[model samples]
Target: MAATVNIRRDVRDSFYRYKMPVLLTKIEGKGNGIKTVFPNMADVARALNRPASYPTKYFGCELGAQATFNDDTERYIVNGAHDQNRMRELLDGFIDRFVLCQSCKNPETELLVSRDGYITADCKACGYHGDIDMRHKLTTFISKNPPKKAGKKGKKGAAGADSIAGQPGQVDGVEDEDNDDDELTRKIREGAEKVMTEEEAARLIAEREKADDWAEEDTSPEAMARRMAALGVSADSSLLAGDGDDDDEAAGPYGEFAAWVSEQKGQDANGLSAAELYKEADARGVTKKPHRLLPVLFPALFDEKVNAELPKYLPVLAKLNTSEKTVKALGGGIEKLVEAYPDTIKAVPKILMTLYQADVMDEDAIRHFATHVSKKYVSKDLSKKVRKAADPILQWLDEADSEEEDEESESE
Candidate 1:
């Protein structure tokens, strides 16, 4: 028996269960006919739960050489005098692409080929099913010559029943089925026998206890925002408050404040009280930070009735918009309002006009909002919609500014 090593050669964990016979190569022929043969290709393929032809063809693709596999002789040959180390590296690449589960990085996965020539890896270890990268040359070959299905068992003494039984000393179709099951069972058994450290045992116990919570899906905006934060993607940071993790405090200056506002609004019949909101904002130390306040406040206070809600919230809005930056943030809040309630898009003109008349937003703020577009508050497409809906108001503002300039020039 050849020496066995971890399926992932890079993982140096001594207790790692998944193992495969190290690839054995023999250089044959001479000069122009020199070739490399993987003598134990069948054993390695069995360990990976993939066809021997896959890695064989993968080498050919990577080396730009012809590869041949004989089903009867179980011989795999690539038309080149490749070194053992180089072949081993290429095999590792093949395993990473075709064998390892994308979700868990485990070797316990089965390739599922669709009729549409798409390959999906179904991971037994993590119960994850994801599409495999179809750009590799092996995908085309696997799609054309898919893995063989195990033979079905019937009543005793029926034809081919012996093959399906996978009895001892059997090397037929039954061998494929039995070998795979044997590999998985051996891995599980080895993993089960390993001595667990106190920390690892405790962690596993905790995970098992909270498994139900982990299974529950959270599609709420706050959940989505936290997920986006984890991926380092930009979103309303204030929406990621109280993620129930250690990093909750890192969400942003206004995250906890926003969460508090959301909680109060949900409990109170009259919604967020202006006096309480001011105190809360001051306690959260964001009253002076209007640039952050407006973005979170708008989403928390108003909904689709923003056109009507604008006046109702005008007093609070006026208190927050104290500077040029806060005024621009107010503009961003309007965009966020439209994003959250797309139906309010047609009401954008009224909303902006109300804010303008109340002096919550100035001419420069409105002009800045009209000229700039960013996905910070809302998608560019939504921003465009909001700007389009507020176009009449924007045009009027531009004309008023032009008339003032004309009057100034005439007075000069």
Candidate 2:
């Protein structure tokens, strides 16, 4: 019977596509001279597309033990009586750091040795090229003993010869025919060079001069506009009128709010109060169109312990969420916050519940927000966390609707 296990712990399916041989650990020696041997290290490393020495060395480094790999004997050993589970855990860490692509998380990667003596992993699956952590002890070893490049095969022909005998314009075992062909080829080239007339030479020279002159022409905006007009194409001046400052002005309110929030990072919010901030925002006309301020306000107003003091800001946020656009903006801002600080916003359900209870987010909006899943804010894992956090609110809303239906049915 074949023993197999999923490549990663996160993949729980018994029939997962990625499977590897179960770790086979054997203890050797006794007392202080204890050593662990991986008999099928070659096969396991082959499955991972890495050298057996890498994982073996990694185990040594992590466990503070000595490791050895004998290429001739294909033996890998670590100077400790480590259990199979512990070795497998260490191997997973190695795979996460060296084998997997940071961007796509795929294991189809090749280690590249740079000219500057740094190692990078180039992924074949997603074409992602990322620098490997140089801090690892294995990096130094990999740098010293880089993977060899595949050699090209030599063409099956005599040295300095283009074609073989009996092929186009060649005779079998004749050196004179090859030499005569070379001489005749040189003569044909010399005769062809003399065929050009003086007028044709002058015309060629004139065309060259014209090309050089065009190459040296000015490429400024006005010059380009004039050139386009000369070529019978229209150029619109209005398209390039802006001074590239509109985007900067558009971020003014959000930027100011963010700056204010940063300034209040460590201070006690009890002194300043959310009502004071709301009043100040209203004074600055930021509260009039709160959707524009939400992206900045949400993160600024709350931290990881948002649920503890969320009720204080509920009234202010509810008042600001006067329209459908503002509600959607607030939802999007929460999503961004969750993405940026997944750990801090683990109480996402409580935040959403506060909004729903305060009448800021209606049933439709809450349902839509609960169903929406996007990778733009965070990775797949964190995205799932955010969605999972909303489950409680979804359940509450469903129960409320059911109660309302029950009342209607009783009245009928």
| lDDT per model vs. reference | 0.63, 0.58
Name the regions of candidate 1 deviating beyond 4 angstroms. Answer: 151-412
- Ten contiguous residues with the weakest lDDT in model 1: 168-177
Backbone clash pairs for candidate 1 read none
* Candidate 2 lDDT over residue span 1-412, tens digit each: 1133445656664323233444567788999998888877765665555777888888999999999998679799999778677888898898889887899675657799988899998875567888999998989988987865422221111111221221111101112212323222233333334433424677699789979898685645565445323322223333223222322211444445444554454466664454456556755766655666675567666667778766666545644554565666677667656654567556788787655433345456678777877554335666566777889888887776675455334323
Position 37, candidate 2: lDDT = 87
TM-scores, all candidates, are 0.39, 0.37
Model 1 Cα displacement at 204 (Å)?
37
After TM-score superposition, what is the CA distance of residue 144 in candidate 2 from its true location, in Å? 98
TM-score of 2: 0.37
